[model samples]
Target: MTAASPPSASRPRYAVYVVLVLMVAYMLSFMDRVLISLMIDPIRTELGLGDTQVGLLVGFGFVLLYSIMGIPFGAIADSGNRRNLMVGGVLGWSAATAVSGFAGGFISLLAARAMVGIGEATLSPAAYSTIADRFEKRKLGFAVSLYNMGVSLGGGVAMLFGGVLVAWAMATAVPLPWGELTGWRLAFVAVGLLGVPLAAVMLLTVREAPRRQGGIKPPPLSALWALAMRHKAAFAAVVIGYSILVIAAYGAMLWAPVHFARAHGMSPAHLGLAFGVIIGLFGTVGLAIGGLLSDRSAKRGHPDAPVRIVLASAVLQFPLMMGAYLASDTTVALVLAAAGMATVSTIGGLQAGTLQILTPASMRGRMTAIYLLVANMAGMGLGPLVTGFVSEHLFDGPTSLGKALALVTAVSLTIGVALLLLARKAIIAAVLDNDRAEAEAG
Candidate 1:
């Protein structure tokens, strides 16, 4: 692990500020990304959509472009001005989200969502590369996980804020002021418009953190391929193994509220507050504990602490998800789901932190991009679609959703754990090798 460089040592306050700015962008991005879930019912009625189409809208539509664009954007982040890249991304996604308000049918809405994905593809890889440079290795896990607080918070705020908008739309004396938009349309417009000022703040206030890797052209895919092959086991463990669990994570994120609505006879207004608090508090706590545990374990001279913690989290997630999805009572299900949320959320950012330890500074951005490309495509892109397919085709009636979720949870987590176990030895070796190289360089 390298010591804090002069810029970081002398400008700790500014580093924190930059992290906060990135976090705001991350939070805002997620808010736009997931807000549609709260209005699934309204959107479905208006657009004449079924469960499969809804799944496509929230999952594939966004993730298609998001996954594909990651590597290109990641390469730019490695050698170009990352802050400016994000400025363009924020503005692009915000505008796309606003355009979602004008979508009248499936094709139009899908296009808008795809554009949002294209913009958001630029965020995480750039942000991860920057964090790796700004924080010392000792603090890397905590800093990355703290930045991931935006994820939990953004998801929670989407529901809570969407609930308010839904309530207002319901209580309106007449049509809304602008274009007579109501319900979900107004929600999209409101959240989308927020990006303008955030992009402004990002462009004007956040300075591009100095790249520790030095300004050099990024290696091409041929080189990155060779790099991954060298650490194939560890890479597979972190990427594919974790992606299996991500299927459950993204699946539940897309469908949990809808499950309660269809099966337990709950309304979005009530479920919003209930699940919002659960995801925000429990999920955030899970990330904090994961970062702390990994950092503390690393301090004790375990270089693979992050990988170990992620595997443990994935193991814990299975039972909780099964119990939640199969529970008979609504209160019991929410309790179990909250527990699962905590368990699954613990895996957040830890994988990226592990990669930071393994990859060279010059290629961290592209590496992170590769991780996201696979993880998001497999997990975020497919999770919702898979669940929807199972429910619509295999199961019957409304309550079938819970059963589908339970089945997916059972399979994904079990395989994910086994794969991670296999990767442990390889990760340990790689981490040790990286540590020696970094020490020699220092």
Candidate 2:
């Protein structure tokens, strides 16, 4: 079934409030997801883990559960109350992160991380669906871009907070009821506790926008499958193209700090601060800029603005990333890395907003779920694991991390550009068809 426009004229002033809540929720999940990166050394020392094990803990373990659960949670979001799903998700991930602080060995820690992924899996599909319901299609690019800033914000804050949190935990030697909770353990416990209040805020302050389906019952799974089959070309392009971009993103995100430390001798705290500011400042700016450019371009008759922007970003990202990895001077490397990150960060918001624009309202949640299931599973599952494997096997030692990163990013970005270009004509056709259908319905 085709989508009809929501009565956007009656959208409440409180819609912005909903975006704020989701943004904070997005930030909370990311903090939990990335805090593990900062704790790698302590986790390795205490758990007697190797690079592969640590990669599994950070990459595949969490994402495997997240990808599997996204389909069900997405279906739930399509048919049920999204706000409640988000509340439950926030609480579940928060609790799991705190539980991770108490894990005794690799097995237990892996289990806890898996739970965290399950909880986080509930967020994006629901949040994106809600934003689509509340905002008009014309403004979706900017709105989704604003919402996606949480990703970079959460990641940056995690790195910065991890540095401070680690330093404080090490200095004070905080005693806990369970045991001597210091270093990485304290970081997990401290960050995990932050979500409790945020969850409460989400429950008390946010209201689910009425579903766009109105009195129409959500279509059956078979019908939904038919709809997906109808739009297979567009879906293939978006899901595969975006997932490929994420490979480069996750690879860089998971390993950039280690690269800087090994190659340039920057300390963790300094590296964290530098990257935190770069990702938080430049990444946010890039998302906003991309969204605005795409939105304005659409207004000027470019129906495929989102995909075009992604293609441009992919083009810019490869060269900058290669430069960052290959550069000898620390200052030059950082400048190039920051530019590369700004481009990389644009993909999340643009792809999400674009998908929302292309899919029907009834299927937005499930379609988003399918996209996440494929994108996260492929990107999060392989990006870090591949980089780590290269570092451990192909390279003589850890110091060759820059070379490994360069090779992975160069390949992924190139593939991503190809897929997006292939998807472009399909995306343009979908946008035009939706416009014609909406006009006819009106």
The TM-score of candidate 1 is 0.96
What are the per-residue Cα lDDT tens digits for candidate 2 across 278-389?
7778788888888898888888889888888888888888989899987989999999999988998887779888878777777788888888888887788888888888
Model 2, which residues run further than 4 Å from truth?
1-8, 437-442
Put down candidate 1 lDDT per residue, 24-128, tens digits, no spaces. Answer: 899899887667878899899988999899889988999999999998999998888899999999999999998998888999999999999999999999999
| lDDT to native, each model | 0.84, 0.83
Q: After superposition, how far is residue 274 of candidate 2 from its true place, in Å?
A: 0.4
lDDT of 1 at 111: 98
Clashes of 1: 0
